[model samples]
Target: MIRVVLPAHLRVLAQVDGEVRLDVEEPTIGAVLDALEARCPVLRGTIRDRRTGRRRAFVRFYACAEDLSHEPADTALPGPVAAGAEPFLVIGAMAGG
Candidate 1:
């Protein structure tokens, strides 16, 4: 199971506490996210758009050294995340005027 740490807002939105664990067959970012959303229905629109299927503008994913910002759709996620050894941190990027 891949460990996922959601931001506080997302946790509140999902009505869940602590870290979320998801079992992924593909060991990819997309797969991990899918499992997360599946487990927490209220998280559906928070991380991604219901129709567009894109990462929400405010949320960002980080793992090890990879930015994964422009990575291909099929790009494999970090090995630790894949192996469920480390948590995939889903943080909200702060922006200011």
Candidate 2:
């Protein structure tokens, strides 16, 4: 199982009280997200754009203290994350004027 920690808003939308656990074979960023969307259909377009399939500008991904937002979708997760030892984090970015 892969642990995924969604931002508060997303958790609320997903109606989940805590981290989400998913079973993914590849454990790539893309695969993990695909599994999340598959499990929680309500979150289809929140983290990524629906049409383009690109990550939203105000969303970020992290694991093992590394900023994975800019990483390739197929990038493999860190050892701990893929091994279910660490949780992959989905964060909402703060924007200011």
Q: How do the residues 1-97 of candidate 1 rate in per-residue lDDT, one tens digit apiece? A: 7888899988888888998988878877788888998999888888878898788888888877557655554678888877878788898989999
Q: All candidates' lDDT scores?
A: 0.82, 0.97
Query: How well does candidate 2 match the true structure in TM-score terms?
Result: 0.98
| Global CA lDDT computed for model 1 | 0.82
Instruction: List, residue by residue over 1-97, the lDDT tens digit for candidate 2.
Output: 8999999999999999899999999999999999999999999999999998899999999999999999989999999999999999999999999
Q: In model 1, what is the error at residue 51, expressed in angstroms?
A: 0.9
User: What are the per-model numbers of colliding residue pairs?
Assistant: 0, 0
Compute each candidate's TM-score over C-alphas. Answer: 0.89, 0.98
How much is 39 displaced in model 2, in angstroms?
Answer: 0.4
